[model samples]
Target: MRITKIRATPVAVPYRTDETWAFGSRSGMVSVLVELDTDEGIVGLGEAAAYPSAEIVLSVLKSVERLVVGADPFRIEQLIQRIDVVGTWHHVKATSPAIAAVEAACWDIVGKACGQPLVNLFGGRFRDSVEFFYYVAAPDPDTVKAEGTRATAAGFTTCYLKVGSDSLDIDIERVAALRDGIGPHMNIRIDANEAWTAGTALRAVRAMLPYGLELVEQPVSGRNLQQLAYVRGRMDVPMLANEACWTRYDQLSVIHNGAADVLSVDNQMDGGLLNLKRSAGLCAAAGMTVLKHSLGELGVALAAATHVIAATPNFRHANQAYGALLSDDIVDGFGGGVDNYRDGCLDVPTGPGIGVALDPDRVARYARLYREHGDTEFSFQHPRALTTGLALPKH
Candidate 1:
C-alpha cells in the first residue's frame, strides 16, 4: 500500500531528574513522533529523538514529504534511497533522525501488513528480552551513590554514569561512590562523551581504575582515531566509541584504526533499523561487539530499537536507555520507568508491528508541554553552557 500522509508531532516528556553531561544538560526528552497513514488504512508509528532540535527535524519531514508520500511502505530500502539520494539528505548527517523516523514507520507498516512482529521480519528473536543499562545522572557523589544503590536494588546488572566533570577528582569521587553503593557485584560503565584529550583520558582513566570500570566511553574526541587508539592501548578497561562511530563509514574507520574495544550504534544517527542491524553485522565481521546508543528516546523509539536488538546477536553489552530518568511516557505501557524492566531487561513485544500504541491522552499532554516549554526547558543547550562555554580535555 502507498503512504497517504505523514503526521509529525513534537512532544516533551519530563525527566525524573536533569540529565547532565559534559557539554550541557536537558531536563527531559524532546521527540518528534511520526505517524504514517497508508492507503490500506494502516497506520505506522515512529519516533525521532529531537537531536539538535525539533525545528530541524520538523523541517526535514516537510522537505521529504514529496519523496515519502505516495511511496510503497513495504519497499523501505528504495524509499530511503529516494529520501537520501533524490532528496539529497545523504550529505546531511543532522537529517538522520527525521529520515530514520520515516523509515521506522514504513517498517511498522510492513510488519502490520504481513501480520508479523518486526523482530521476526528482521531475523526472528535471537533473544526474548533485551537488557538495558540503568542511567545514573551525575550530580554529586551522594546522588551517584544513591542512584547506584537504586539501580542495584532494581536488579540491574550494569549502571551507566557520565564522567568528564570539570575536575578529574570529582569524577573519581563519583565513581568511588557508585562502586561503594553498588558493591562489588554490579558493573559500572562511564561515558565521557568525547570530553578529554588522549593524555587527559589516560590520566583520568588510570585514576579511576581502582573503582573497577566495566568500560570507558569516548574518553577522547571521536574525530581523532589515533588519539582514541593511544588512550585505548594504555588502558586496561575497554574503550567504547560513541561520537567516533555515528555511521557505517565511521565504524569502518574505527575498525581500521583499532580505536575501540566496543562501538556504539544508533538507528536514528545512522539511518534506520536496517542500518542498525547492518552496523551490528559490520562490527561482528570485525570481531567487535556493538551496543545501541541513545539520544534520549521514549517508548516508541525504544520499542522500535528493541525489536532490532532482540533479533540480533553480538549486542553483548547492556544497551543505553532513558528509563531511569523518564518520568512518564506517551505510550501506554512500555518503557517509561524502571518499573517496566524486569532484572534490567525489557521483554520483546509479541504484538504485530512495533507492538506499542501511543496513548492519546498522554500524547496530547506532552504535546502541549512541548508547545509551551520545549525550547527553554527541554533544550539541550543548558544556560550554564552558554555562559561558561564547553571546557574540553578537563585536566
Candidate 2:
C-alpha cells in the first residue's frame, strides 16, 4: 500500500536514576516515534537513535517525511535509494542516523503485513537463543566484583564492566577482583568509553592481561583508526570497535587497518538491522567478530538484534541486558522473553515484528511527560533526542 501520511512525534522518558559513563551523565531519554500511515489503514511504528530531542527529531523528520509522503511504503529498498540520492544530491552526511528510523519502521510494516516474523523474511533462524553479556555499571572494585559474581551466578556467561573513570591501576584491580570473584570460566569485557590515550590503553591492557579480558572496547578513541590499529597491534587482548565503526565506511576502515578483533555494531548507530547486516557481511569477509552494542533501547531493538545475530554466524556474543535491567518496561510481559537468569543465554522470541506489543499506557505516559514538562528535566528539546540519551539543554 502507498504511504499516505508520515508523522513524527517526540517523547521524553525519564531515567529512574541518573546514568553516568566516561563520556557524560544523562537524566532521561529523548525519542521520536514515527508513524507511517498507508492507504490500506495499516500503521507502522519505528524509533530513531542519536536524537537529542529537538535536533535529531527535526533532522530525521525533515529527511524522511518529504521523500516518503506519497510513495509505496512496501518498497523499502527503493525508499532507501531515494534517500541516498537526495542526500547525495544535497551533499548531506549526517542523515544516516535519522534514516535508520525510517528503514526500521518500514521493516516493521512489512512484517506486520505478511503476518510473519521479520527474521523469517530475511532468513530463517539459526539459534533459538542468544548468549548475552551483562554491562556492569558499578564504579568500585568491590562493587564490580559483587556485580560480576552476581551476573555470573545469575546465568550470564559474560559481563562488561565500564572503566576509564578510575586510574589504570584501579581499573586493573577492579577487573582482577571481578575475575577472582567469578573465577576462570566467565568472560570479562571492559569498556573505556574512549577515555584513554594510546599510551594509557597500552599500559591498561598490559596490566589487565592477567585477568583474561575478552576484549577492551573503545579504549583509546575511535577518531583515529591509525592510532587504534597501533594499540591493537601491541596488545595481546582483542579490541572491540564501538564508536569507531558507525557506518559501512568506518567499518571498512576498521577492517582495512586491522584495528579490532571484535566490532560492536550498534543497531541504532549503525543504521538499524539492514545496515547492520551490511556491516556484518563486511566483518565476516574480514574474519572479524560482530557483537551488538547496547544503546538502552527497549525490547523492540533487542528483538531486532536477535534476528540479525541469528542471521550472522560469526557474532561472538550479544550485549542485550537492558530488557532485564529496566525497572518497568512496556513490552516485558507481552512476549515469552526471559528476564530472569537462564544458564547464561537468552532465548530469542520466535514471533513476528520484534515479537512484543508496546503498552499503550506507557506510550501515553511518556507523551504526557513531554507535553507537560517539555523535556526540561531531561535536557531534551524533542522526542527523538530522548531516545539517544543525549540529554540536551532545554530552551
Candidate 3:
C-alpha cells in the first residue's frame, strides 16, 4: 500500500537502572513516536531515541514527515535515499536519528502486511531469543554483591558496570570490589563512556586485569582510532568501541586501525536498524562481535533490538537490560510484544511488523509528562568512589 500520512509525537518515559549511566544520566528518556498510515488502513509504529536534545530530533522528524508523506512504506531504500537527499540538500547532519523512527515504522508496516515477524524478514532467525546483561547500580562492594546476587536470582547472566571518566586507581578499586562481591563465575564489562585518556585507560585496564573483565567499553575518546589501538595493545582485556563507532565510517576506521575487539552499537547511535545491519555486516566481515546498547528506552526500542539480535549470528553476549531497569514500559503488556525475558535472555517476536502496538492512553500519559516535567535530571559522577557509593553530580 502507498503511504498516506505520517505523524510524529514526543513521549517522555521515566526509568531507573541498576547502574548509573556515565554521561549526564537522566531519569527518563525523550523519545519520538512515529506513526505511518497507509492507504490500506495499516498503521506502523517506531520510536526514536531523543535525549539531551529533543527539539533537534523533533525538528528533523517534521522535515522528514514532509519528505515521506506520499511515499510507499515498503520502499524503504528509496525512502532512505530521499532522506540522504534531504541531508545533502539542507546540510542536515541530524538526518539519521530522525530517520530512525520513520524507518522502524516502515519496517513495522512491512511486517504486518506480510503477516510475519520482523526477524523473519532478516533471513529467518538464528536464535529464538536474545541475551541481556544485568546492569549493577550499587556502588559499594557489599551492595553490589547483594544486588548482583539478586539479579542472578532474577535470571541475568552477566553484569555491566559503569566506571568513572577519570582516575585509574579509583576504577581499579571499583572493579575489584565488584569482583570480590560477585565471585568468579559472573561475567563483567565496564563502560567508561569516553571518560579516560589513553594513559589512564591502559594503566587502569592493567590494574583491573585480576577482576576478569570481559571488555572495557569506550575507555578513551571516540575520535582517534590510534589511541584505541594503543590501549587495546597495552592491556590484555578486549575493548568495545562504543561512541567511537557511531557511523559506518567510524566502524570502518576502527577495523582498519585494529582498534577494538567488539563493536557496541545500537539503533539510536547509528540512526536505526537499517544502518545497524550494515554496521553488523562490517563487524562480521572483520570477525568482530556486536553488542546492542540501550538508551534506557521504552518497549519499542527494546522490541526492535530483540528482532535484530535474534536474527544476527555475529551478535555476541547480551543486549540492553530493559526488563531489569524499567519500572514500567509504554507497551509492557500490549498485544503485539513486550519482549519475553527469562534467565537473562529475551525471546524474539514472531508477530507482524516490529511486533508491537502503541497504547494510546499510555502514549498520552507520557506525552503529558513530556510537556510538563520535561527532562528530569542530567549528571556526571566521581570516578573513584568507594564505600559511600558513587553519586552522579547534576549538570
Candidate 4:
C-alpha cells in the first residue's frame, strides 16, 4: 500500500500537578500523535516523545511528507534511510520522531496487511502477557510510602520510584519509607533521571542498601559513563542505563566500559519499535539484559512498547506511567483506563497490528489543550531544576 498522507498533531497529556509531585513538578506534558494514511485503506498510528519542542516535532514530521507520501509503506527500512537523504538536501534533520513515527506506522501497516499482530512480525510471543513495574509519581516520602502500599495491595510485584532532585538524606528517607510500607517481598527501583554528581550518586545509592532497592537508574549524568562504571564496580546492585544509552552504539560504550548492568530501551527515544528490539538483541548478544524504558507514556508509543516487549525476551517487566497516577491520555483504552496496568501486568492486545484504536475526538481535545496552554513539560532528562529551599543533590 502506498502512503497517501501523513498528519501530526500536538497533544497535552495531563499528569500530576506540582502539589502532588515528589521530585519536581511538571505543569504539563506535551506529545505528538502521528497518523499515516495509505491508499489501500490502512491507517497506521505512532507517537513521538516531542521533548523541548512539540511544535518543532510537528513541523519536522510534516516537512518530511515528501519522502513518505506516495512511497510504498512496505519499504520501511529503505524509507528510514531515505528520510536522512531527503532532509539533507533541504538542510533539515528528519531522523527524529518525524521519521520514527512514519517508520512505526509503516510497520503497523505491514502487520495489519498480513492479518497478524506486530509480535508476529518478530519470531512470536515469549510470554502471553508482559509484566510491568508500578510507576509512582514524583512525591514526598509519605506520598511515596502510600503509593508503594497501594501498589503492594494491588498485587504489583515491582515498583519504580522517581527519586533525585533532593538531598541524599531526603531521597534515602523516601526509599526507607517505601521499604517500610511495602515490606520485604516487593522489588523497588529508583530513577534519578541524571540529577546528581557521580560521587554523590554513589553515596546516595550506597546509603539505600539497607532498603533493598532493586536498581538505581541514571544516577549521574548520561555523559559520565566512566563514573557510572566506577559506581557499579563498587556497588553490587545492577545499574540500569537510561539517559546514558538509547541505541546500540551507546549500549556498546556502556557494555564495553562495564558501566551499567542493565540496558533500558525506549521505542520513542531509540527511533522505533524495531530499533528497540534490535538494540535488545545487541544487548542479548553481549550477555546483558534490556529493560523496556518508558520515560512517560504518550499512549501510542506505550502501545508500541507493549508489542515490542511482548516479543522481546530480554526484559521481564516494562516500565510506563499508567493507572490513576496519570489523569488524561490521548487513547481511551490502550495506555490507560480499561487496558491499563492491573496487578502489575498488562495483557497483550490480541487484535490486528498493535491492538490499539485511536479516538480522534479525544486526540483533538488534547490537541486543543496543547494549542491553548502550550505546555513545555517534556522528558525527565531535561527536567526543570529545583533551585529553591529544598536540598537538591549537588553534582
Report every candidate's CA lDDT.
0.92, 0.69, 0.73, 0.73
Worst 10 residues of 3 by lDDT: 378-387
Candidate 1 C-alpha lDDT tens digits along 245-343: 999999999999999999999999989999999999999999999999999899999999999999999999999999999999988667779999999
Which pairs of residues collide in candidate 3? Answer: 18-137, 19-137, 111-353, 112-353, 155-344
TM-score of each: 0.98, 0.86, 0.89, 0.90
Candidate 2: tens digits of C-alpha lDDT, residues 27-73: 55555566678888767767654344446556667756778888887
Q: Which candidate, 2 or 3, would have the higher lDDT against the true structure?
A: 3
Of candidates 4 and 2, the better by TM-score: 4
For model 4 the TM-score comes to 0.90
Residue 8, model 3: lDDT of 75
Tell me the spans in candidate 2 whose CA falls farther than 4 Å from its real position: 9-18, 50-54, 88-95, 333-341, 370-395
lDDT of 4 at 393: 45
lDDT (10s digit) by residue, model 3, range 117-220:
99988777999978888777665666766767767667666888788633556567677877776678888888888877777777777778888988898888
Number of backbone clashes in candidate 2: 18
Ranking by TM-score: 1, 4, 3, 2
lDDT of 3 at 301: 72
Window of ten residues with lowest summed lDDT in model 4: 380-389
The reply for model 4, stretches above 4 Å from the true place, is 17-24, 88-95, 322-324, 337-339, 376-393
